[model samples]
Target: MIDGLDPEYLDACPAPNLAAMAQRGFRVNGNGMTPSVTNVNNVSLVTGSYPETHGITSNYLLDRQLGEEFYMESAEFLRAETMFQRATACGLRSLLVTAKDKLRRLLSDGATVSISSEDPPGWVVSGVGEPPPIYSLEVNRWVLDAGRYAMSQEPFDLVYLTTTDYAMHTYAPNDPESARHVTLLDEGLGAVLEQAPGARMLVTADHGMSDKTRMLHLPAELGRYGISARAIPVIKDRYVVHHSNLGGSIYVHLDESSDLNAALDTLRNLDGVEDAVSGEEAAARFHLMQERVGDIFVLADPSTVFGDPSEVAMPAGLRSHGSAHETTVPIFGCGPGLDTSTAARFRQNLDVGRYVFEDVLPPRPDGLLS
Candidate 1:
């Protein structure tokens, strides 16, 4: 999966290899699960379910009892089974290669081999040479190169490759750098196709990137009315260079003394807030984990973001995601089993995993096959 790929990027940038794959097979516009952030959608892709089932509502979570924050990057946080685990139960080997270690940790439950560019082992370094810095565009190429090398060494029944979104976050669709990045990805994809001649190829994105011009601190806004709260940006991660811990959606945790209705009304009337709803309403509408979410969910307009109150000045040329606007993603499938008729069934990004697990190699009712 391409981390931040969108339909506009594919259309504006020249990626002949990907275009050919879409032409030879089928290309359809599919929606991603909301809030459209990396961890939420990536987990949904692997688990073939929504956050309600997988229990990963955000990339970061708050422990209200302990008043501590932690990254939701561990496999233990997942409540649903992954496709890789199911494949293993079926006597099949799966390989997972990702640009970020967080994803490697989150989706490596039942993989025969798992590697990440962020912390490649000595063997991976030897095979692919030294990897580039995770913040650079070359790092994504390194991930694909490593995956190609691994596939050549051993046969894997299922192979999953995911890249980072540094280029997408830094460059606009019309920029020359964006075109170069797409070309690099195309070349890497072609190499993978050559290595596995008969393997089916499915490509999709975790979320789409959007240019954000405004940043809102919901907590500070509520403070004007003597309300105490904390606004957690759902897209916040260790990679601050990509987004500066700003995103289009935020979870507002109100103090016990705050008036919930008043806070919700104030947030809805904010300049950049597109929609504000109670936590229960948000969970039901978005299929999220209710307990993991906050007291209120606030969605910003496409051009705005949510950040800390101290972050008064918006970062120049900042691009981020985590809102309904980014739900639109392109889904491409090629090879024998996938055709126009089959592609018609895919309405969301998670459908890709469902197709592989339920349609391609479903679990037998009896038990593990010999």
Candidate 2:
């Protein structure tokens, strides 16, 4: 899975391999889970379920009871079984390679082999040479190269490779760096397919990306009306350089004295605020886990993001995501078992996982579905 590969990026870059695969098989626009952030949508793709079932609502969350904040990167937090776990139960070996260590920790359950570019194993570094820094574009190429080397050394029934969105966050679709990034990705994909000619490959992204011109601190905005609230940006993570911990969606926890209806009304009228709804309504509308989110959900317009206004200054040419605007991604499939007719029905990122788990892989021995 590509972290932030959208149709616009593909159109801006030259990707002969990807284009050929799509022409031979299928390529279609698919929807990703909203508040289109990494952790939420990655879990959705691996589990073939929505956040309501998989239980990942954001990259970061606040423990209201404990009054602490943490990154939501634990596999134990997942409420649904993943494709790797199912592959293991079916007596098959699975390989997982990702550009971020957070993803390795979050989705490594039941995989026969797991590696991340962030902290690659000694063997990977020895085989693929030293990987570039995670913040650089070359790190993504190193990840694919490492995955290819590992696959060549051993056999696996299932494989999953995911990359970071550093390039997408740092460069616009038309930027030269964006073209180079996509070209590297396409070349890496071609190598993987060449290594396993008979393998049925499915390619998709966790979310798209967009350019932002403004940033808003919801808590500060609400404070102007004498309302007390804590706004948590859902896209907050260790990779602050990629997005500055800013995004287009935020979870607002109101103080006991604040009126929910009044706060919503105030937020709805704020400039750059796209939508404001109660947590319950947001959960139902976006298929999120209600308890995992805040009391209120706020969405920013396409050109705006949510962050600490005091701590984060809006950078020039800032590109980020985490809104309805980033929900559309490209889904491509190729190989013998991937039927064009079946691919036609794919409308969401989770459908790729559904197809792999339910149709391509053998059914569970216990006859139970995930």
Best by lDDT: 2
lDDT of 2 at 21: 89
TM-score of 2: 0.98
**1-370: candidate 1 lDDT, tens digit per residue:** 9999988898898888888888888999999999988999999999889899999999999978889998999999999989888888778889999999999999999999999998887888999998899999788889899999998888898999999999999999999999888988989998898888788999999999899988888888899989999888899888888888889999999999999999999999999999999999999999999999999999989999998757645898899899889999999999987788788878999999888877766684457531
Taken over the whole model, the C-alpha lDDT of each candidate is: 0.90, 0.92
TM-scores, each model vs. reference: 0.96, 0.98
Report the C-alpha displacement of residue 187, candidate 1, in angstroms.
Answer: 1.1
Query: How many backbone overlaps does candidate 2 show?
Result: 0
RMSD of each: 1.9, 1.1
Worst 10 residues of 2 by lDDT: 337-346
Q: Give the Cα error of residue 123 in candidate 1, in Å.
A: 2.4
- Residue 327's lDDT within candidate 2 is 93
Candidate 2, 216-288: lDDT as tens digits: 8889889999999998889999899999998999999999999999999999999999999999999999999
